[model samples]
Target: MYKDLDEFITEYQHTADFWYDVGCVMASEKLSKFGSEDWQELSSIVHNRPLEWQKKLAYCLDTSCNMYELEILLSLLNTEDEELFEICIDTLRSFTTQESKQMILDNPSILNRVNDLLPKAGIVSKKMLEDFLKKLNA
Candidate 1:
């Protein structure tokens, strides 16, 4: 694994597989040292990377992500790529706290889009989808 954060930053930051590798590492490690700067770096990678890379990173984030990272995951909902959008939505399902729910409902359009897209994605259970919709409508 990564020896330390600085080493990871210096050596992997500009590599072609940065996001993919970082995502895997994040999913597997607590990496609690990550602060706003690290989140920004990860977010930047997710925002700037190719669709395939984005999908891989989204999957990794889905496996394990914190509240601070929710916005990055939410931003991915805007993608037109179906696979990426589905992976993003699946990742988003993990953030079920009141704050996360409210943050999502704050963007009515994105919430509505989630309502529209969930069925097409066909990844979430019917009950879970219903609960999410109820929370959004509430």
Candidate 2:
């Protein structure tokens, strides 16, 4: 429908209330995972009812979602990549112990690439990557 994550975020930033209904749809289609404690825990802080709500939410979550499943869910911003939806499953398969830095080290080369770009990225970017690394180290 939306076409891409960027598009979804953009649209949501403009009108996130739509997501209330979309969330309902997701619920109906068994998308309740988006409402789970993990999701709700994070959503509680980010889900603000404002014109810029979704953008802020995306920013907050993007920074905070260090775990693989949460990282994968961020891609939901991408609207057309239905196949990309498996990010969560793939992340789960590559699960890491909450107490192991090996998880970050164990991540595929691609995540390394993502990390590599961190220092040069903006504040949020650097913070997000750093947070992920922190979790791994924790």
- Top candidate on TM-score is 1
Clashes of 1: 0
Residue-level lDDT of model 1, residues 1-138, one tens digit each, is: 213533443334445466555645654453456666777767666666667656655655643357656777788878888778766666676777788878887878776766676666544544556665775455
Residue pairs with backbone atoms closer than 3 Å in model 1 (clashes) = none
Q: lDDT, candidate 2, residue 11?
A: 51
- Candidate 2 lDDT over 29-73, as tens digits, reads 332234345454444443233424333233333222345235434
Off by over 4 Å in 1: 1-27, 30-33, 62-65, 118-138
Model 2: worst 10 consecutive residues (lDDT sum): 82-91
lDDT at residue 84 of model 1 (Cα atoms):
81
